[model samples]
Target: MSQNRRDPEQVVAAARKGAAEAQRQQIEIIKQFAAIDCGTGDEEGNARVVEIIDRQLKLIKGIEITHHYAEGYGIHIVARLKPEKPEGKILLSAHTDTVFHRGDTAAYPYHEDGDTAYGLGIVDCKGGILVAIHAVRIMQEADMLPNKEIVFIFNCDEETGTPNGHAVFDTEIPGAEMAFVFEPSRDEDGVLTARKGACSITVEVFGKKAHSGVNYLDGRSATVELGHMLVRLYENNDNVRGIQFNPAALYGGDYGTGIVSDHATAKVGVRVACQADIDKVKEIIARVEKETYIEGTKTEIRIDRISVPMERNEKNVQLYETVHKAGLLLGKDLPEQASGGSGDASYFSYRGVPAVDALGPYMYKIHSTDESMRLSSFEEKTALFAVVLGIL
Candidate 1:
């Protein structure tokens, strides 16, 4: 090693100091992120958030930034930092969009009280974005940036199942050795080692329409058939096995009770623990589509979106070990967990890149009005990530 190059302990010490110095700036940046109304499908709102991130990334020299736009979806930003003699590629990702819709920020503006910060979408992902930004900034400022190709992805669609973000991953993640997703850590300070697969299904039922009083027996009730199918689907939910079958919304029938309904539609959400469980869910759906409660009714099942599980495998475990070692350097023991909620991390893992998640601030009540993050965690996680980058 060159005399000018610091040892591992010295590099980590410099990163820790940088993280402490950047704490106030991180909070201000997170507030700016929280002020944006970048809901999942709000193109304009998402674009505004993208601009904020772009401006921040511009502050770091030698970064190559590109914007990828998906028709009918929002923009996904990819920033790259290439060293002269690259060791390998590292992927760090965080979503720009949140579950909060437009006008949510106006209703509940970003605010800090005591040791916590609260606002719409503050913790769900806005905080995560700040973590990634500060981590890179810390590494750059300390002159401790590794000799690797660092790829940072700020996806615009994640709350709605990453409709457009996956395309960005397909292009960028191929040669990356490992990935880190800056989602909020679990309330207990646990990082995600595994996540269940999720599927959004739309079931439509068709039936003959007729006047209830004039031809009640001739017409088949689609609503009645839908109810039976929903019951069967809900029966597949096994809490003990971590399988969730939720019939979230139902729509059917006209206002007049005298008329027999012709159409019915239902939206169902399913979560499975493993890849095999996905097949089981599909089998159940196939059986439901084939069987009918009403003799004349026909049912159609359409999967709106599907996210495969991030199973706990050796590669993922090895990545977690690296993260754990980094956490130990910071005097923290980061526990690994298997989450029921799915995330973009699963996409990279499925594509053969070792991945770990929940590397952001400690947060709770995500996607709810009470969503908030611990202010101190911003500095801690930033330091953790900077050290991880250094040691890598």
Candidate 2:
């Protein structure tokens, strides 16, 4: 007969063991990932990661791992851990993509000093992945694995907003009960409780090009039309609601020999606090689109919802409390915080699954060359996750 509940003492002990093991194993994982040149298009990163997963699954609960080819980028690894029963499925998501390309190590060398491991993607997510894996180990070893099933999704291309991973999750996320993301935590005491939603938009304006010296008055400049739209876009930014509009990229006909630009396009990035804000921004963008500043210019607009905001609520607050208290028991004060970026947790939170982000080890300089994680922070967070699992 199998046991229904695990002893608290046994669970605690197992968590401690798991935490220790995680530290040791993390060194290997880091070294392995370091060997891969997984910038974005490199397939070696995927191959190396798959090899590590193969070894990890053998030691832990080996689940099905699939490789997906996301357009415009490299492959994404989707791994699942299914329970015997079909209830209580939680997802732990992380990203494997980084902003650095091949010659990055020369600019930002990967090295260790005393207790900190420094390298690309170390703090941004690889360290976070290590934390999640150990958390699962704590639960599995203590026989206190979630009463619900769990899905461990470590994807590629998150550095660029799941451009490819989003579709993959669309097929897999509907069945999850909750999710926890291993994003880089704020300084040290921070836990990400909320994030703003983001949208990428491009507004194109077309006009008749004319000679600047001779026919400037006869032609309508598309650049002028784009300028007017950008003015309105900036005005729509409501800092109170965290709704921000930024004209990120602007391109028009020939810059060096710009006589009268015939076409101009601007890529804007909008960040909203919630879905309501998203709709509001859409309204604002529509209004801007209707107004044609240049008399003869034809304008077009395209919008893409990059990532939805991870809105916070009572349910997430409860989970945060559980995690916070666990940290206190480990003699650390972990505070639940909020962020301004989007991540996979947004999918689950919007689905009413209640999630928390930044449960990974404390790290800094993520998405950049100076990425690194503290050995002590990882150890404490690992133990706290174990404690939280027991309480849950």
Candidate 3:
């Protein structure tokens, strides 16, 4: 039997209503959160929001939000939507924390300009969080929620590479069968099916500190040693093969004081398309760790595997199929895309659960001071989300 085609007029109307409701609901939540500055290690900020959401959850049936704390600066919020009867589980993941320093949002809150909103974390992820909430609300109103269980994960720390967040998730929801990450989509009409593996690493060099003029020969410069390692790391960059290693932050001695540096630090961000390539590059990092530039200076390496690549698979094909059919019913088409940026979808897909990211609306200038999500894409994405849930 052919699925009944949905009228674009009616669908758009429903989407418009849904979007308006969502925006209103979202704005309220944002205002509440914006009142409190939710930076990493801000327990009070996280607790305030979690407590509010929990109280609201008590009134809603089959929905529960749990809070878990990871080691320093790590928190995970798991929102579970379970139907009366059991079905497959679907995970919708988004991070709540922003890259901005503490009190940034409090100082510069959300502001609107025609159709766009600008704020510290507005586009990077808070918009995605609001989208998930509104989508779920629509699902409840339509009474079309599937027998399948839906879980919305609001990770506390994603901008910091989810060191503790990933561990908490792996321990909590090991049974999830599928996941959709509400990360900011790329440009317009962008959807993500694949992402590169990511790593967070710190390079520290130690050297003797001495006065520049009196004991210049007595001190080895750690900053110079760090530069050598950085130069070597850059030589292997290959844009064609999707391999890029960048030095995100570097700190060294005080230059104006004329003191030879005794310590230096550098943080590196590595992205790789394939697991084999990621493993291959570790040799280069290891080589740098072993070699020393300055005499009597030593270097220490702290390499961490934050998240792995989500390779394309058959399960992803099935998900795209369902999403595509739902789009057709609504007279829209959402193309499958492979993304290079890393997201929580990488965590689920790497663990064998098929996942798709960039499921939210089109967002621009993410992680910037002028970030914004398109006004139209909000309704479009929510409608698509509701339709997909009903179909499943």
Candidate that would win on lDDT: 1
C-alpha lDDT (0 to 100) for residue 242 of candidate 3: 71
Cα lDDT listed for each candidate: 0.85, 0.75, 0.73
What residue runs in model 1 are displaced by over 4 Å at the alpha carbon?
1-6
lDDT by residue (1-392, candidate 2, tens digit) is 12236555666677777787677777777766765566665566655765775566455564666777765676666667776675566677887777778767556666788888888877677777777777777677767765666677778777667777778777777866667788867666687778877888999999888888887898788888889989978987888877889998899867545488888999999887788988888888888888887798888877865578888888888878877866665667888888887887876687777788988777777766678878676776677677776656
Model 3, residue 312: what's the lDDT? 79
Considering summed lDDT, which 10 consecutive residues are worst modelled in model 2?
A: 1-10
> How does model 1 score by TM-score?
0.96
Candidate 1 least-lDDT 10 residues: 1-10
Total backbone collisions, model 2: 2
List clashing residue pairs in candidate 2: 88-148, 88-149
Best-to-worst order by TM-score is: 1, 2, 3
Clashes per model (N, Cα, C within 3 A): 0, 2, 0
| Per-model TM against the reference | 0.96, 0.90, 0.86
Model 1 clashing residue pairs (backbone): none
List RMSD in Å for every model shown: 1.9, 2.7, 3.4
